[model samples]
Target: MMNDCSLVVGGSKGIGLEIAKLFSERGDVTYILSRNKGKWLGNHIEADLSNERNLNHVLHYIRNNKIRFKYIVFAQKNRSLPDDLDYELMIQLKSVKILVEGIAPSMEGGAFVFIGSPSGRFIVREQPLGYHLSKAALEHLTKYYAVNLGKFGIRFNCILPGTVLKESNREFYQANEDVSNLLKRITPLRMFGEAMDIVNAVDFFSSEKSRYITGQVIFIDGGQSLEGQESLARRLTFGED
Candidate 1:
């Protein structure tokens, strides 16, 4: 069953923002996580992902306050560009796990969401190797947690989004005719997916709507992974059916 007081890690901007908005409207006490402070419709928690201590502190606050929660969505977004190889990918996953560990005790059989990228499940570019590796490991972690949390009636799942257009990337794509045209032609939907698409799915699975579901990886791509994902012919469908 769904309950009030949900925590959304990386919920301050982009895709996370959509999730926060939906949950808040549903009357859930939603907590949005971001390192920077700004005005949001829902409550905001300012903290960096690399900071383990801060993660623990927030978790401790929730526990101390006896804030029972129903959903914990980790849409913690990070993009490892070709030049940004120095970033430690594991840090993101570990940080999310820390928060979950703290909140798990207070959850009454809920859903745990890990926002992953389609690159981890399918073809990965040579440039973002660390990012791909991290997401792949995240899937394994999700499975492990799902198995353990099963006894507690909590579900663990991952969402792999393909070619999500963030603010910076959206501008780049819109400006580049060649890149924009090619991407649209390849994806069956012939368009890019909005952040709301992802958040809505998380909300459904995290609510009582997905109580019997667990250990699943949902892809939010608009048939980009279809068997015929090419410059020709209709592509076969894939993911999150």
Candidate 2:
């Protein structure tokens, strides 16, 4: 029997936790994994996603409960330095691959939503190079999986969010006024996004609303990625102040 269950990795806080909360509110059997337990009143599985043994424990629980996920969200992040690229790749890539292998058999007809970043598609030299490179690789991996797993009725897509203003990171943004100005000035929307925006996108992908969509990368970046010399050229041509 197919169950209304979801597995949210790296969901203890930030965007992932918000998505998990949405799932739980809708009465879905949600499972969350992160270093710390979130404030939600649902199941929170403690596991270091980068550690094989820890992930094994999580796999065991899923197998024991016979929980088949209808939605799988990979919201994991690794903000380590360039020197720690190996650990970052392990957590953001290898771990996700392992989780998919472990649970994909039960994911027939389900949707896989990867919480990627705008860095995946565009060149971002300001941030850690490792971070940008890993996400780029992840985007390709999403396409590869989408093609291979389509036969099993599984759909894969990526949500590339940019400059999301979450409550947890309010202080960081407030302290970095220059960065905040750059984000606002570059984005066509002239504003930063909220966590709920991404959650809403995920909801659509996970439901029948997007049944025909697969192997797509949706950017929720408020048009920030649409800026650069092209934007300047357009302004010069149109004389828009």
Candidate 3:
């Protein structure tokens, strides 16, 4: 059953959920892992990525299921804006380290795709939250993992989105006016990307099409990054800024 199973961490909602659906749609028996079931549609694991004990349990689940896979898709984000760097580091490192450790030795010759955001590359002149800093660290981690795992037939890569528009992002879109308009102009596609956009790219990586691509950060933002940091403040009000 090699290449028959696909494991997706944080696949309950948003981009992660979409990636899980893509795997299922393509006939890969997908396992959706998450701490809580949440409101997303998918079969899910009730375990915490930040918890070390749960990581052990996660491994047990994989082994007991005898699930060999051709892909491991990751879509976890550190959603914190703490005043202290240490606390923030713990949150960011926990998800990346545990998942990297759990999936690497278990899944072989498989493509590993992570959903990343543009915050890691261009400092959004406006959104300087620790979450963005954490993402930057993750981009580096992606490269590091790709380098170390290349010999094992493992490919690690990420998709960075400019503005992943969804129910979760509706508030952000409403709050940031200029950022929204800029998205309309720059993206050559001239439209906001749906969850499917990220899913399609990840699917490519999982299949033979992207067997040679690794440690790369694909920007799914259309041409939004080209708009520069100024787009960060596109829709801010006097009080919000």
Tell me the whole-model lDDT of each prediction, alpha carbons only.
0.76, 0.84, 0.74
Per-residue CA lDDT of candidate 3, range 1-241, in tens? Answer: 4337887877777778777877888888778877665665555767676667777787788779766666887786545445545545555656667767766786668788877667777666655466677778878888998999899988888888766678788889779988887566556566788777777888888887888889998798777666444554553333222
Q: Write the per-residue lDDT of candidate 1 for residues 179-235, one digit (tens) a residue.
A: 887777677788888777887788888788888889988788888887443435433
lDDT score, candidate 2: 0.84
Q: Residue 85 in model 2: shift from native, Å?
A: 1.0
Q: Put down candidate 2 lDDT per residue, 61-160, tens digits, no spaces.
A: 8889778788999997764445477787888888889888888887658899999877777777765766777899889988999999989989999999
Which residue pairs come into collision in candidate 1? none
Model 2: ten consecutive residues of lowest lDDT:
77-86
Instruction: Give the top-scoring candidate (lDDT).
Output: 2
Candidate 3 to truth, TM: 0.81
Comparing 1 with 3 on lDDT, the higher-scoring candidate is 1
lDDT of 1 at 85: 36
Clashes of each: 0, 0, 5
Question: TM-scores of all models?
Answer: 0.84, 0.89, 0.81
TM-score of structure candidate 2? 0.89
At residue 97, candidate 2 shows an lDDT of: 90
Give, for candidate 1, the lowest lDDT window spanning 10 residues.
232-241
